[model samples]
Target: MTESTTPGTASGIREFRMPDVGEGLTEAEILKWYVQPGDTVADGQVVCEVETAKAAVELPIPFDGTVHELRFPEGTTVDVGTVIITVATGAGGAPAESAAVREAAGSAGAVAAGDQAAPSAPAASDEEIEPEGRQPVLVGYGVSASSTKRRPRKPQAAPSVPGQPGAAEGGPRRPEAAAIQAEFNGHAAVVEGPTGVAGAAPAAVRPGGRPAGSAAPSVPGGRPLAKPPVRKLAKDLGIDLATVTPTGPDGIITREDVHAAASAVSVVPAPEAAALAEPVPAAAGPAREIRIPIKGVRKATAQAMVASAFTAPHVTEFITVDVTRTMKLVQELKQDPDMAGLRINPLLLVAKALLLAIRRNPEVNAAWDEANQEIVRKEYVNLGIAAATPRGLIVPNIKDAQAKTLPELASALGELVSTAREGKTSPAAMQGGTVTITNVGVFGVDTGTPILNPGESAILAFGAVKLQPWVHKGKVKPRQVTTLALSFDHRLVDGELGSKVLADIAAVLEQPKRLMTWS
Candidate 1:
């Protein structure tokens, strides 16, 4: 992904939008920020690191100037093409003007003290105090003043008869739950007093009722404070904002607060009903479970696996092979002068054996084109080796493996494994593979019916090699043995073709001399 440059505005501000970091990815999470407001930056300077569905990548700024603002906070997943940061590109304004521009933009989204309506200012008129300044022209948020609408209050209950409770006090009729509508978000809620329990009575009464005091949270026209997104969320969940207590700064309701309120509404009873309900003990220690947000490679991998599993009909075949000779050959290759400085391991030979099988059975290396109703046979072999990393499982292939020499193939395989292990495998490296190999043997696993990588025709799972008693030449003998499971898209490779490919790999392993005659 590259920086998107916007034409300079009159404020000398240039908005830098998030680019499409992967193949048409819609969004990326800002993992960390390297610069803050007022920090000087240069062209091509790395400003932040972001994790898309594919991988984590560093984003560099294309403009050289003071970083006027960072639009989103760290860990925020922003949509592609949204302005992530803005810079003072220096055009039609003085340095002071630029500084003020930055300040206005920064403060516009900030929470302020006295964010609620002033006590002297009546709330019944749907009016709000605006910050005094030339409003910063943010893209999504409007500059118009914000206001809240108070729900109309219901009438108080008629005074009780002479013998009733209301009559005993010789006072006016007491207000019902709806009477608190004016002081909150118009919901007939069990109003809580300053002590944070339900009040003895409703706070805001209509005409001919108790006068509201400092204890009354909001006046007749005021509504609960929340951002537009939070308001939308509350509306979607059918929750009244006033009934939801705000925990954010300056009495603003946040998404978490709204969600918590929704959950409470569903599970917990109202205070009046719960008064007669049995009490339960509160939790006494740290939470029992932890939550990890899935993003980047893991998310993409999960989606791909699901799609592959359901879309492609897979057939797996297993074979047990005696690889005592192949093990010796691996040691011999490590000592070969031509293989010096190259990584030598059983995986290297296994990869070569699979490449040979694909050459012998080319139809197994083909893809089913459902849309075109045809089979696409590939000529070149992009042999994929599945490597597990801290981020996730990524299979980066050695391109054109069928043409590579023994030492060259060893070098490519080594580089691929090391790069994936270090979490440096690029998106391009993981794309367009025709076949794959998963070395489950590294973990001492016997075998697994491996799932095909999305878009790839087949995958091979190599199991643990260990000394086991076997009938060698009709006599009991100890030999190196391993199991191999090959899973292929049945739509492309039939039973005969799939079996032949798997058998060729086993044959190459069993007869080490085939390396001289096969090619």
Candidate 2:
């Protein structure tokens, strides 16, 4: 990913566009913005972090300037080449430009302040409680400031006469009470029909505790009077809007009214729960279920895994091996002067073993090109290590693992794992791998049928290393043992070829001395 700056709408201002962070990727979600609008930023300062389908990457500003605006807020996915932020190339930003921006903003800030008297400046004492007069809207949007413009009070429609043209019903006249607007604690509210309107009218209730005394505004077909948000809330809770009472101005159903109806019909109430109002209270009942939207790395991982699982014919072969000798070697290598300060673990040796095994059975390290009806054999190994990060599972590969010495491979492995854990692995670090290894052993798992990484032919699942009774040298003895499972794409690797690869890896692990001879 590269950051570039282009001349903005105004002079001395540069707009920074969201860069294509991965090969062929068209968009990235803004995970966070480190700098807010109006903050001073220097050249090369990391302003935000973004997540592409492949990995999370930090984007740095390309030039020194004061942040003029953050075009998008966090959690927004932006298309590549779209301008995401603008900067003013002045030490503290030019006053003229700032003034121009404010003029463009107009009363949007007052709306964002969410108060009645937002246009007036607040006293120093009030500033501690209220926000500044010139507050920015959600990413500085004018239309989204939530205008304080109230709808005009809908006049009571002339009562529909029975048997008249366009009368709703031709039956006897139903006595509907007149709607009465009331002030409840200094707020304007309209009470619906009086408690005597009909069945289930909710007991002569409050206009401050007296049942509503007026007719409500209704649609031509009598579908009930509710705003879109209130209707959505009722639908989500499985509440019928027609059953809810209207306590809002102009006979409109409210969110609180729906909650009150819901509480009235609840089958059970917890002993600790209490009705804070006449009947409206956020039910203290524990939620039955919760839903989360899948996105970012986790969503991408799921898509790739599903594709690989169904597209590739996988065959997993397992073998249990004694690694007592290998375990002893790991300890001795830790003390060796040449290996000092280097990572010395069984996984390092396991990786080396796998590399050697691939060399012996090169056919297993190839891909099936169905479109061309050809087999693509790879001469070099770009080894992938499956890492579990907070975002999801990611397999970042070492560029050329077969040619690296033991110390070099160890250092690379350490760096790869650390970068993944820190959520800093770049998209390029995770591409172009011939094979992968997943160390399920770290979690004490015995074995698993590991899935192949998309585009790769094989994967290895390494199980926990533990002391077990084993037949060794014609005798049963306590030995350090572990299970290894190798899964390969059957179309590319036959059972015989897969078996040989698995056997080779087990042999090297069983006899560490074989690493020198095999290589």
lDDT of each: 0.70, 0.71
123-217 per-residue lDDT for model 1 (tens digits): 34453344565444433332233354333222122333677764544434334333443225422233334333334453443233333331122
TM-score of every candidate: 0.73, 0.69
After superposition on all C-alphas, the RMSD of every candidate to the true structure, in Å, is 7.9, 10.4
Q: Number of backbone collisions per candidate, in order?
A: 0, 6
8 Cα displacement, candidate 1 (Å) = 8.5
> Residue 259 lDDT in model 1?
71
- State the lDDT of candidate 2 residue by residue for 319-404, as single tens digits: 99999999999999999999888878999999999999998988888988889999999999999999999988899999889999
